[model samples]
Target chain A: MNRDALSAGLVLLLMAVQVTFVNRLPLPGDAAPDLVLLAVVGYALARGARAGAVMGFTAGLFGDLLPPAAHEMGQYALVLCLVGFVAGRWAESRPEAGLAVALGCAALGPVVAVVVGVVFGGAEAGVVALTGGLLPVMLYNVLAAPPMVWAATRVVRGRDRSRVRSRERGARRAGRLAGGRP
Target chain B: MKDTRQARATVGLLLASALVLMTVDHRSGENSPLGPLRGAGTAVFGAVEQAGASVARPVVRFFEAVAAAPEAQRRIEELRGENERLRYALAAQALDHRRSAELHRLLGTAGLGGYEVVPAQVIARRNVPGFEEAVELDVGSADGVRPEMTVLNGDGLVGRVVQVGPSTSTAALISAPASSVGARLEGSGEIGVVRGAGENGRLLHFRLLDSATPITRGQRIVSFGSQRGVPYVAGVPIGVVERVEATPGELTRIAYARPYADLTALNVVGVVVRPPARNPRDAVLPPAGQNGAGR
Candidate 1:
């Protein structure tokens, strides 16, 4: 019930939805909105640099596995890590961090994704493919981010406080157990 | 503080790994180690996906059932009529079977020819939008499939196998931009090279053997088979001529043909094993008539 476990479960849930359901939505050329990126960005904004970086890597790894054509493994992980780091840093600077972080990350997410895709996927990448396939996808993800963030906020705000308390109790119990062992 | 540095180092390592993967992929043209890792990732993701689908299936089924109610009723009525028609067709087929048996008996044929048909289910689709003209089929080298073999559905030609792997083969549909087939007009006997024009149809560029003989619209075109080295079989129905035009006093006529098979609705297809011999020399025209043509 700890934050890390909850985040991990959410990440898997989002990735599964992304691959099986969201991708099947009658989007242009089978393009799906990047739900994993949104989750990473949201977590980064809520937490800080270290958390963002870790979550981003996990999400990117999941994204890399979603497509058969995504033969390049760590490319997504790298790009998403950078995305989370930047967003996390930006979130620290802003007063109304949640919405601003979500919007900003949404805007920048697609550019990073396309650049990484082209660099790894090869030279056969066409303008039409980028514009039609990747661009619309980015736009869709950006549009989808706010609602998902709001929903996550509701779930996290309700469950996270209790989860954090339970984790603290467990940590204290572990500390006592370790102290008594020797 | 050290943890922050470790996190940065991890990110750096990931980036470096990505770059190395890209380099390896570019140089080798092979699926990198990343691909298998990604596949494993997908498998995990796929499980969650399946779980989500299982949760949502009843809702989807309800909606589908509601939507299909009227259509289902109409379909039942239509099926009743179709059953009557099919019964008549079946009777006719029985009569034709008797005649066919009599002819075969006169020819001293005892049994039906031995032919094996294997059914393959499409597992993955990899149609690169606007660039490549092929999709990968799950059946591959494991299924006795090889490159350059002709693929056909119940209607007509689908495409040819281009890349084969242990478990998968990429079949380039005829509608792809890179696809080229040699075809000859069924009526006029004009030979031409049919190339996919990156559209729903193909562009037939005819080689004018004699400038005097002009091709008209609505002419039937069939595969001209292989030339000296080009790979394709003869007598495969390519398409019918939709439009033809003389290129403003040019020697040859340019025509567009719609492929006989519906390229998009492809599900099951048969791969023709033997190559058909319908070379340019095999065209009914004499060598004198074939001279000066460049197809």
Candidate 2:
């Protein structure tokens, strides 16, 4: 319960920073890293599938409700939820495979978001967005995933880091998966 | 890890709810039932975003300055030469009428297009990639920012106020796929609609009302404004024509133009609460080829 609360608070902060700070940066590309997605992937790797899914949902809901919302209320929530769940499965089974999963999930997120926008919103606008925004954002997220993923796991699953570092295979608890490159 | 079925159920449930919520919001259309909810969220999050923005501004500015170092270096060299020549000219003649005129234009209180504007800093930005681009401003309804008030930077039209909270409000960018503005050709006065060219936000599609009006690559476009200037104010620079599309048999000719304001890098902007008494026409526009890289 305490872990869940900590992760939730962290995600909320990530969402706030993403909207206010990250998006405002004069980055090279038109898009910024989806910090919420990165946090979700990281938290999932640390906390397992159920907690990951719930975390993703909460984070996505925050993204939906936060100000300057251009998309519909539930659009991002659905995408993040799925990313969290699959990332959790990787955590549960192959805990050492953290960085790869984070990269894969982060890359997959924008594509899913584009699909969701087309299905739930307008097809024409979705096509236009995918063509223009998808590549740069995908690349940005993937590049950012490694460091952000490591940081999230460290922040959310602090106690477990020592255990993972000591290479205690199979001694890991639920909601505390080893993250990053083995 | 062992509770696989339960975890799957939770995922399924959350995904389902999100889908339902999206569908309800989408179906509600213009007058969304979630309007109040959105407003409430804005009120709550606006304060948080403002606080966060204040804390983050210095950090962001540092990175921006670093990222722009090369350009800034080049600019410094150019300015040094210009400064040397300016000092020589100033000594030659203490009369500085041309310089004063430039300073007056830069420092004037009368905003672009003569609108009474409330200056606001962007506290948060929500960019939905190719579909939507919106930003939350620090000043809001408390600052007399009503919904539909025109938001512009010195460069040109940014967007318009959409949702106003007590201390903050959101404005969609002119580059948003959903945004379309009424625009007029600089000299011809032939009106048309300029729609956001989605995705990269590098260009806008202007469809001339009359296909035979002959809009060339170097033509300029300005806001036609709206009734009482509710959404857009008159004569604000929109963009300069970049390329005219060949629509051989179409009634309206199409051209793509680059927006004056750098939509990708927005900071301080003004929201026009009161539009000019008379249309400024081409006066608000930056002299052709100065900011207008039309051709």
Q: Which pairs of residues collide in model 2? A: A47-A175
What TM-score does each of the candidates earn? 0.55, 0.79
Q: Per-residue alpha-carbon lDDT of model 2 for B1-295, expressed as tens digits?
A: 3499999999999999998888888789668988888889989999999999999999999998999888998899999999999999978666677677788888884354355789999988877565467899999888998988999888888899888899999998888766789999999989999877765567787889998888899888988876677798776788899988888989999888999888888899999888666554545443455323322
Q: What digit string (tens of lDDT, one per residue) describes model 2 on residues A1-182?
A: 67778778878887888888888888776788888899999888887788789889898888888888767888788888988999988767776777888999889887777666556645345334566677888999999999999898887767554332225533554325455335
Q: Which candidate is the best by DockQ?
A: 2
B94-132 per-residue lDDT for model 1 (tens digits): 989989988989987343321123444333333332333
For model 1 chain B, give the 10-residue run with minimal summed lDDT.
B286-295
Q: Which stretches of model 1 miss by more than 4 angstroms?
A: A1-6, A26-31, A95-97, A123-127, A134-139, A151-182, B1-10, B25-84, B97-295
List ranges where model 2 is wrong by over 4 Å: A48-50, A89-97, A126-131, A159-182, B1-8, B26-33, B77-114, B187-191, B207-213, B246-254, B277-295
Error of 1 at B114 (Å): 12
Candidate with top TM-score is 2
Docking class of 1: incorrect
Chain A TM-score values for every predicted structure, listed in order:
0.76, 0.83
